[model samples]
Target: MDTTQLLKGVLDLAVLAVLKDEDGYGYDILRRLRTAGLDEVGDASVYGTLRRLFQAGLLNTYVVPSEEGPHRKYYGLNAAGRDQLNRAGKTWRNFASTMDALLDERGVAA
Candidate 1:
């Protein structure tokens, strides 16, 4: 399967999950996602997701001045974001569990 399509479906959740613990700038968020095994996630996708989430009222943003280069716009989850994360997480777990069972019944190897 082309993982890019799969990534598209879950990128929102993944980004939200990463921001759950702390706020981060764009590059920082991208780095964290890659570090977490989502190496295929693209720069544009992360940035766009951030924009969409913020517009959706799921995230709060602010700029932090940096001495190195430019001001970094940081993104953090608000209450609605955390609530969505909890709900999406449960949905993902249930779907994954169902898929796992189907695969096992069909004798697919782990």
Candidate 2:
């Protein structure tokens, strides 16, 4: 089954979760997501998600000058973002549980 559609719906949550503990620059964030087993995550998608979240006032951004390369703009979760993460997490958990039950009932492996 194609996972792209499902991935689009949860990308925001994934991004928010990734930034929950620490701030990261674009490529850094992408790498972390890939390392976390989200290998299908694309660079542009993560970068765009950061920009969107920042524009939506859900993320904080700061620039750090690099000695070896260009300055990096890092994104971190703010109060609003945290609130969103908490709320969205609850919703996702509920949805996932429901889907799990449905799949089990249908004798389908989750």
lDDT of 2 at 7: 80
TM-score of 2: 0.96
| Tens digit per residue, CA lDDT, model 2, 6-47 | 888999999999999999999999998889888889889998
Q: Indicate the worst ten consecutive residues by lDDT in candidate 1.
A: 1-10
lDDT of each: 0.97, 0.93
Give candidate 2's error at residue 1 in angstroms: 1.3
Q: Clashing residue pairs in candidate 1, if any? A: none
Model 1 lDDT, full chain set? 0.97
List clashing residue pairs in candidate 2: none
Off by over 4 Å in 1: none
Question: How many pairs collide in each candidate, listed in order?
Answer: 0, 0
